[model samples]
Target: MPDFTTDHTEPAADRVERFQAAASTAFAPLLVRAHDGPPFHATIRAQATGGLLVSDIRTSPVTVNRPAGRISSSDNDVYKVALQLSGTMGVAQDGRREVMRPGDLAVYDTTRPYALEHFAAPDGEIRTVVIACPRHSFAAGPDALREVVATPVPATRGVTGLVAAFFTGLADELPNVDASGTHLADALVDLISLTFATPPRPDPSALTARMIAYCEANLSDPTLSPRTVARAHHISVRYAHRLFAETDRSLASWIRSRRLDRIRRDLENPLLAHRTVAAIAARWGLYDAPHVSRLFRATYGVSPTTYRRAHSGGF
Candidate 1:
């Protein structure tokens, strides 16, 4: 990992400016306002994890903003997840506001306008650790992503606790390590995946939220093969397959399962009771009757027709 460690110990007049310059390059353009007296003392230790930047930071009371113009000029299209190591930090973005305390973290998109206010406690300057996650690393679609964006993800317990621990310890664990961060990257992405995931779309961002969105929108087109998917996304077929490989199912299997799930739902719908199993299957681009039947039974423990019949009629 590439490392950068800096401490702003310059005279009070120049420290804030120097800190602002260093911050802009390390993260993004921000209008930084100091709340404490001048000659601000700050520290930032950041390292690149190939796909993400993990940093440990301590700063005097200040407010940072990524305004609309700055967002436009230098949009990395990445997301920032910051863990409050000590003191209090407040974040506001996308019309949502949150106050994060120790053991609390929040995520905000760099592509959007946001503000972070770090307050100095009686003890000292606010301390925090932040992770700069490339947008592509997130697998959740835009809608699902919204649920956590600018929202506080508590790290007191559950899987979120584990994620918090990872971010908290990453700075110390990764320094001077020469190996690639493939596994580490996957873990960060996976935890972020879990943090933002919800029911009705429980399927994680196996192929990234964008790729999954494209696949879902064209699921019924029949022409939506891996090659076509790759072409549409301007990515190679091998890359597309590799993205799916990150999940428990393959690309073809995922598509098939999604199609079957839709077909099953429609079959059980009273409005679609008049539709034949074959028609329902075709509507979802599943034309192979025997193959569909076999998979459906294997998945749901009942053939498509039987499942539909059992659920369609009144008791």
Candidate 2:
């Protein structure tokens, strides 16, 4: 598994330099901004797995200028899916103008010409989550998907929402992945395939539910957070909180419980005999051995080591 995370706050000039340096390597630049100043207060994370590239980006107010043409330098074909995480984004593609609000998703082909303008408040910024997949990898035909590309599609419901949620959840858990990273990556591909196979509809609640399930499946990740989950679903931190609240659990507590469950399972696995209790806990994002021991005792009424010793015989 390959993971990269960058958090930066620098002067406009330095920031632009960094942005250009980063973008030039991965994405082609027609017109790079932050020229006036770095208007984008941004957190950008990108993950590549099973031929899919997912990026979670939250930016301060800024304008990205792309003239009506594809970058002549890059020949790679990518289908870009952008979900508005906060505020609004105005996108113009093939002479059609679309306004994307929170919970809305839009797709654009890297082979075409389009312009995206991210709106910001006097003191606020715009946030978005973007997933880029090879055009050939999408389950639906390129033409079939193109009809919705660059147009505002609702993600608060239906298959699109489910897909958004899956991507977000996967992003959060990418860092803690171990030998099972390949399986997780394959699962993500399957989810994306499901998303493209479903008919479009409006069901934000349904999407949130699917997202919760995805999170549950990957609870061992220490990097999981409300922000990461929300970004996956193309929503806000507050909105992600609301979804969990509906389930009667805060995000943090839910993650903790998930880690505990994984530890419990590991304790019983005779094949994992060589791995220590602390190693298992750390694999699931529990860094402090003492803390894991304490939490295990509080929840399961026994220390992890004791639990492992008792359960190991069963396997």
Candidate 3:
């Protein structure tokens, strides 16, 4: 991969304009603005390694915005994973905000709206290594990725620290690895992905049981979902699904079955027979009438109304 470096002695304004264009060209559509005054300096040294676009940036104070108006399905799904090498950066997305210091890691989706501010230090410059990774190449699916966007993955220790160290080393090695850097790039991505994954547990069964218990307790909540369950259990959506793979049904189907079972129990209770099918369904968080009817018929070989009538002597 041939490296491209842009650092010219043009006027401060022209330098900003050219830097903004170059930054956008290097990544996706971005509005880059120089934050400090005249004679501002910046450089963007970019290289493509494996399937990743790595940009080593050193610039004066600047702010970058990814606007909603510029977002489209046709726009690339590559996410920007920034490793703060020097100074600080403020990141905002999905209504969450955080400031990243040196050795910190953060990711942002290109297809969504986000904001970034590269703040100047006492030395009057900030440096960052930004890697662009496509959605498919990433290990975490979209849901998991959304869980982490604009959220700082601190490089204080452990796997995150190791990942940050790799990026720091890659900055110097990137200029020389055009011929043999693909494997290294891939490993770095995998490690970073692992850093964002759920923390390890000694027993999958225990976690699964706890997650199931949470789902059962929250069945009356209309917003109950796999994602919500995962959040409640402090796990990943993918891991939550994996935990239920050996169960009687998939996680989603199991939730539906449990809700249907509760609805049936309620309908069979003679004291509760006055409640309508829709009302009973809603009581158990099965809110969509037509969809719930289809599920109920498919599961019990009868519609909710028929089942309720037969169970309660013609309700």
Candidate topping lDDT: 3
Residue by residue across 56-157, what tens digits does model 2's lDDT show?
665655556555464664555777777787789887776556678887777777777777777763457566777666777667887776555556666776
Give the alpha-carbon lDDT of every model: 0.76, 0.67, 0.81
Give me the overall lDDT of model 2. 0.67
Off by over 4 Å in 2: 1-11, 35-40, 68-70, 121-123, 177-315
Q: Relative to the unseen true structure, what is the C-alpha lDDT of residue 72 in candidate 3, on a scale of 0 to 100?
A: 75
State which candidate has the highest TM-score.
3
50-97 per-residue lDDT for model 3 (tens digits): 878878888888899999987778776798899998889999998767
Off by over 4 Å in 1: 1-9, 177-179, 199-315
> After superposition on all CA atoms, what RMSD does each candidate show versus the true structure?
16.5, 17.0, 12.6
Residue-wise lDDT of candidate 1 within 73-190, one digit each (tens)?
A: 4456678888888889988887766677887777888877899999877788688998888878778876767656766666877888988888877856656532467788788889
Clashes per candidate (backbone, < 3 Å): 1, 6, 0
The TM-scores of all predictions, comma-separated, are 0.59, 0.53, 0.61
Score candidate 2 by TM-score against the native. 0.53
Worst lDDT window (10 residues) for model 3?
1-10
Sort by lDDT, top down from the best? 3, 1, 2
- Of the two candidates 1 and 2, the one with more favorable TM-score, higher being better, is 1
Model 3 ranges off by over 4 Å: 1-9, 200-315
